[model samples]
Structures are given as C-alpha cells and as structure tokens.
Target chain A: MKDDVTIINCQLINKAQALKDVSFEVKKGEIFGLIGPDGAGKTTLFRILTSLISADSGQATVDGLDVATDFRELRKHIGYMPGRFSLYQDLSVEENLQFFATIFNTTVEENYYLIQDIYKQIEPFKRRRAGKLSGGMKQKLALSCALIHKPVVLFLDEPTTGVDPVSRKEFWEMLKKLKTEGVTIVVSTPYMDEAQLCDRIALIQHGKILSVETPEKIIAGFPKKLYQAHSENNYLLLLEVRKNPEVKSAFMSGEYLHIVFNGEADETVPNLKEIGPSIEDCFVYLIEN
Target chain B: MIIKIDNLTKCFGDFTAVDHITFSVGKGEIFGFLGANGAGKTTAMRMFCGLSKPTSGEGRVAGYDIAKQPEMVKKNIGYMSQKFSLYEDLKVWENIRLFAGIYGLDGKQISRKTDITLKRIGLMNEKNTLVKELPLGWKQKLAFSVAIFHEPKIVFLDEPTGGVDPIARRQFWEMIYEAAEKGITVFVTTHYMDEAEYCNRVSIMVDGRIKVLDTPGRLKDRFHAKNMDEVFRQLAR
Candidate 1:
C-alpha cells in the first residue's frame, strides 16, 4: 500500500473494535502521530505493524514487507518502545542497552553513533539498576536501547504519558533530530496538544479515526464561531452556556469556559456574556458537532 | 499551612535522589510538583510523608517536624503512590479498611468512612469485588479514596493518573477540588500539562533543582508561554 513504512486496517475483539477499517500511512522520514485517549486502539495498531500480532482481517505492511508474512524481515527494520517501561528492571542501564543490542544481533558500539546523543545523557548512570534510574533517565535509556540496532522505522506508543514536561520536551526534540537523520517515526499519544508537534496526526477515538491532517489544518477546520467566556463562577457558566439553544457546546479550558455558537458571533457573545467560551470553546465545538 | 518543606534533600550512596528543595503548601491550596521522571519530586514527597529518610534537610507537615516527628506527620497526611500500591488480592472494601486501620481508625469509623469513600468514587456497587477484578480507572480512584479515608489534613498524590482515561482524570480532579473545598491541602506531581494548569501553584524541577515555582498563570506570564508545554520547552532548553 503506497510507499509507506506502515499501512493497516484491522479489527480486534468485541471488547474493543480496536481499529475499525483503519488505514493510514507513515511516509519515510516523517514523524506521524496517532492521537487518542487510552483504549483507542493505538497500541493494537502498533503491535500489528511491528508484526508482534496479526490483524483479524486486513492487509498491512511495513517497509515493503507484509506484516503477517515477513515478520522476521520486518523486525530487522523496526524499533518499538512500548507505552509502559518494559525493559528488564533487574539489569543495569548499560546491561539493558547491551542486551537489546544483542537481541538484534548487533553491538552497542556498532550503533553507538545512532544513539550517541541520548545514550550520553544516561552514560554517567550506566551502572545504576534500570529500576532505580529516574523517570527521565529511564526514558532516555529506553530510547537508547530501542535505537541501539539502528532500525529504519521507530514505533513509540504513548512514550510521554507519565514523563515530566522537561523530559517530554527533550524526547520530542530528540525525535526531530532523528527525523533529520532519515528515520521514519510513528508515535502515539493521548495528549491532544502534542498533536501540534508532529508533521501530521491522525485523531482516533473509540477505535475509529475521526480526522487525519496537520494540527493547524485540523484546528482551522473547526466549523463554528468560538469564544472565550469567563465569569465570577466558571463551572456554572459552562453549565448555563451548554443549555442555551444558540450555543452548540461548552467545555472548561484552564480558568475560562470555551463556548461555541451555532449562530452569528455578534449576537452569540452578548447572549453568552451572561455565560462564556475560550479554547475549550473550540474543542467542544469540534467534539460535539 | 498543611505542609512545609525546608532544604529537603535525600541521597543514596553517591547519588542524590532529591537535592535541597524547600516549599510550603497552605490549607486548601492545590500545589503541583512538576519535574522530569527522576527530578526528585517523588523522593522529596516521600520524605515529607515520612516514607523515606532524607540524607539532610528539615521539614514539617501539618505543623509537625518531618525529621523529628515523622509519625505525627504520617498521621496527619495521606499519600497515593505512583505505582498501584493497593493490595491486588484484597476486595475493594478490604483495601479501604486496611488503609483506615493504618491511620488508626476504629472499626465503626472505618466502616463509615469506607461507605462514604466507595460511594464518592462511584465504586460502592463493586465494594465486594476484588481490586484486581476492577478496571484501571476504578483502581486508581479507589486508591485515591483509600489514601484519604481518615480525612487527613493534607493529601500527597504521586503521578496518580498515569494510565487512566481522560474522563476518569477529569472525575479524579473533581474529587481533588472537593477535598480542597473541605480545607485539605493537595500536593500532587504530574507530567500532563493540562493537569498542571489545574493546580493553584506549581513547581517545575530539572536535574534535582526546582527551576520554576509559581501560580500556573504567573508562570505562564513570566515564561511568555501560550501553554504549559511551551513553558516547559523554554525552561528545558
């Protein structure tokens, strides 16, 4: 399917539709994001593309190799970092890196340059047990292990979910640098705001993709007039605005309420002046309508 | 003030988990502790709750010296760990009773508190279910409610919403707000930028030092960031 690093359309069990007729492509050297909340089937998609599991019914391929048939060949070209910390906790940081490298039939020194930037940050703590390293350091160590084999396609599942803001920033910066070096990255995150950081993002909800576009394009596609409204009572304002017939929807954004108007903006603001909307206004408009 | 930390530091061998960091939380304030994974927020919190000893530093919680009167501090504060700390094999009610017992609650008080907590978290219908049988969201909520079973003066939550759904997170925050309204201080650490904005004041730590500490609005203005993510990016650089 198209010269993509990955393409999939599969379904899991009934507990989760888990990718209902989903089809997407990750162009070479591009950072593609799968944005969705937990149980939105992000992990299932990653596993299928990585050839760890086969989809119930769908054609899938990564790097010109069939995911269901060319499992071994596909494994050689893809690196996966699971959402949870899955590296061996009993191993030292250095040992874990070396272990992953060995599993890929490579040496840490052989691909040292590929992971040199991230590895160096945790090199000083090389002797520390994997379980004992700080969260940021653990994240770096995990990335280093993932890249130790110098794979062409990297799949990260919610890599920044629990990471601190600084670590999350550092991780994204590293991903950008990796992209410059010609690596195709496919990362998933539940945080909608992170959708802006990627080259393009596919917004998935309840196992179905709602939209696929650049963050700017998606935000610009917002259909109704939006406004930020704040009053002495923010929560009550949101509840009151949602009940108005002219208002499409209302949700909280930081200290203010974002309200979307179904009618003209001029008339809506005065009516909503008694209530209010802001960024939450834009988000609600998109979600509800 | 519900919590006070002064020059709090903790070290193991040659590595320092938490460096000298000082902060205080007033009653009813939702204080957010922001930091990288290993930036020492957890260590600093543990010390304040008397879970871990500080290599050096002085602290107090609920008007008791942390270093000298750790038991008193423990008695006054509730803690929810980053890891799922509840006993998996225990029923939801049993787990609640265990925590209540740890805080020295009597039989009648534990029963009364357990009923209220189960109902508050919307898990009263599943009180007899084993914790392991519940979903991740329910487990997280139950753990949070258990931590505060004794009506602690202050509650410390360490990455309490890591793997739950967004709707569950919103509900959890509502509970936190309810607690705050009852005059209990909330001390929490999180990586989610949206969650950070909910705190009354926040501290961002990097490399074992607190680099930014202020109300989210003030921090946003001071850093000239459109959002917390941008503020983090600027400070991280």
Candidate 2:
C-alpha cells in the first residue's frame, strides 16, 4: 500500500491568507492532528487536500494521487466529516447511512464490519429522526456514515467540538481502532490537550505553522520552568507576579495559576509572596513576550 | 438570587426534554449547564426563560413564577440562542436596536445601551455593517451583547462560543466575567469541557437528568479524575 501523503508550499487566499506556505505529510496508519484555533487554516488545508477547493499555490498528493488532477479517484478513497453536523437532518438515522453508502457505490452491509462498533450504538434509534438523536448519538451516526464506504483516508474537522465528553472519548477510541486497521486519519481540533492524542501534531496559529512534533516533545520543549501558584487576591496576585523579574509567563489552569519562572522555583516563591501571582500571569507572559 | 428552579420537567410528545431538574443561581454567579447535544440543557434553560412550558414543575426567575408570570420573567431575563438569533439583513446597530425595543427600552436608553455594547464588543467601527457581513466570532459577540442590552438580572446563553476561536472564546468569557461582576447572573450551556471548567459551578446532565453538580475542583476529586473530560467519562459510564 502507498504510504506518503504530502502537501508542499500550500497557499490559499480569500478574505485573508487562510493558509500560508503550509506543508505537511501523514504516514500510512498514523493519526496526524492539526491543532490550532479557528481560522488558523486547519479547515482550509482540509478543503484543499480533499479536493473541495484548490490552493492558489502548492501541491498535494494522497496515496500517490494528485489532489488537483485525480479528483474522482481521491474522492473515492477519502472520508470527510465536516465541522458541522451536515447529514440529512430530515432523514432517519438508517436513511442517512444508506444514502452515504450509496453515494460511494457501496452498501451498508458491504462495509458493516468496519462501522459495526459505532453503528451499534445508534442502531436501536435507526428509525429516529437524525435531528432528534442526542448529540452523542448524532456524532456516532456521523462517524458511521463517514466510514460506511471504508475509505483509506479519513479527514475529520473538529468532530468533537459540540459532542459531550463521553462521546468525544468514544470517538477518539474509535479512531485509534481504525488506525490499527490501516486507515490513515487526519483530525483537526482547537483543544490543546487533545494534541497529545495524535501520533504527531502541527500547532498552527494565524495561518502559519508555529510548531510540529509529538505532544510530549512539544510540552517538554516548553522553554521555562512552570509552577502552579495561588494566593489571596488571586487576580491581583497574578498581576503582581507577572511584573516580577523572575516570572516569565503565567496562565490559568483551572482555579490555580501556572507560572513560568526564569529562575529557580524556591527562590521565585519567596520573592513572589511579597507581591503575588495568579493564573493570568502565564497568559500575559505568552502574549507580551 | 436572580433565578431559581424546582423540579423542572419538560416533555414533547411523550419524550422528556428536561426531566425534573432543579437548580438556582445567585446574583453574580457564572453557572454552567452542560450536557451532550440534545441532553436537555437547552430545554431546561428555555423553560427557565419561559420560552417553553414545563410539563410539570415550578420555576421562579427574577421574582416571577415561570408558569404564572412568563411575560414578567421574559422582561427580566435575556437569551442568546445556539444559532445566531440576530437578523442577518439588519445592520449591527439595527439588530441591537430591535432587541432593545423588544425589551421595552425606548429612545435614549436604546441609543445609549447600543453605543456601550458596540464599543464593548470592539464593533463600534462596524455599527453600520450588515450582520451577514460580519464573521462568526463577531456575530456571536454581537448576539451576546444584544441579549443583555437591557441589563437584565439574568442572562441565558446557549452555547455562546459554539464556533469561535480560542482567542475569541477567551474574550467572550472576559465579557461574561464583567457582567457577572456587575451582579448579573450568567446562565450558560456548552458542550466544551475546557470551557465548562471556567464556571463558578457546573451541572452535568445525561439522558435528561442532572448527574453531577459542583465546583470544577470538587467534581474532579469526586470523580477521581484529572480533568473535566475524565470526570464526564466516569459519570457517563
């Protein structure tokens, strides 16, 4: 089986430069995550590679088929779940699955094994209206519909954005299972913590690639000593700590504050007690410096 | 306290949309109501806001019984829907004015509140721009600002940050904090787990019932999980 999925010097422009010289590749059977905030070019890149839109500059090939030239063949081999729940809301759950399968010149029974685990969750509600199923169930139905044709490559754009936590976990587990079965998956999300779930991730910001690496490597490479600090007048302490000489960055991680220090934690704590530091300290540090 | 709900239950054609859920919000609390899509959080909020009637139960918001004084309840609370609720054909200022009028704000109050809201959302320059022309984030901010244009005692926000950027989401929460500080109870619903952690307290609903409610820290500890994501998983299982 062909392994390389390459995008080189990709560029696209509309209201803004949605993507700027973006380049990346996904190896066969690997889950590659495109991690970034909205309008960070994740969806734009997905559109280009899926042949839904053409990039003004740069080229991409998936499984040795040119995205621009082999549109029909590429369409047949890639499954895409858009950010929005774009299935036929008017139809029943069963009808939606049957419709997607038919579009690919296949039948649900033909690929039943591939979608069995996901489909079973919603099978009891097969007669229920697509719009009537709970959010988690809707997510499962979408996944089943996407996989009904058993595409070699899967592209999901923020699929878990509106899904509940349980559904999100279940979806990720399904992706891992599919990867083991040899499907190359490219998923995009703005959730920073989810970056760790991918085999490799590219952190994109403002249409540019900020960093790309394994999740552990990226966090380990974070350049400053981090500490969780809090005190009375939490907001005021955060402001004061940010002004301190030794404090590098501070951000809110739940109720406590994560403060990055330029010096030793022990030394910094004593000095910070005189002033104070809060979670906002890290966010200010990231933005200012 | 600005809002109180007791045994609130809502049903549509034999299906319980919200089942016997009860909660209350203080004057300045940022209360988060969480559930999967179609999990009944929205339905509960609607019943509280008096947009939909409860099948059986009682609710009081801003000193008005939801069933007996829905108009009074509507006059005292604001609502922003998951979908953009502003008229797309109308200009930004026009949308604000329309909502203000709906809440009975007249003349100077409408103009004054509209100006403040426009400036606060950093959309003062786009006051004349049509809602359709604005980006999703801008539209969301505008919808939120419009919802609270009358300075209601309680604001119900349904998935307010649905499709915006992290930066935009951060900014939106900042605005929420500002409102909460001014003693307006903020009732919000979202499926985003990370965002759920920002609330003063969060209630997680599953299968039309509230399964857990507490501060994020306590919920994490109660579920013996590292984060809200795991907490939800444990409870869901």
Listed for every candidate in order, the interface RMSD values in angstroms are 2.9, 3.4
What tens-digit string does per-residue lDDT give for candidate 1 at A1-289? Answer: 2455656666655464467888877788889998765567888888988988778888888889998898998899999999889999999999999899999999999989889989888889899899998778888888898898998889998888777777777788899999998888999875655657889888777778777887777766766656767665554565567678877655555556556667754344433443322222323344344
lDDT (Cα, tens digit) per residue for candidate 2, span A1-289: 4665798888887775478888887899999988766566788888898999999888999888899999899998999999889999999999999999999999999999999999998999999999998778988999899899999899999887766667777888999999998999999875555556899887776677766677666655555656776653344556667788876665444455566667675454432322233222322333344
Instruction: Show model 1 residue runs off by greater than 4 Å.
Output: A5-8, A14-18, A231-249, A261-289, B7-20, B54-57, B106-120, B124-130, B133-135, B163-167, B206-212, B233-237
lDDT of 2 by residue, B77-163 (tens): 989976758999999999988888888889798997778778878999999999988777788888988888898999999888875
Flag regions of model 2 displaced more than 4 Å. Answer: A231-251, A258-289
Clashing residue pairs in all predictions, respectively, total 11, 8
Instruction: Compute each candidate's TM-score over C-alphas.
Output: 0.86, 0.89
- What DockQ, on C-alphas, does every prediction get? 0.42, 0.44
Chain A TM-score of candidate 1 vs. true chain A: 0.91
* C-alpha positional error of residue A30 in candidate 2 after TM-score superposition, expressed in Å: 1.2
Predicted structure with the largest DockQ when compared to the true one: 2
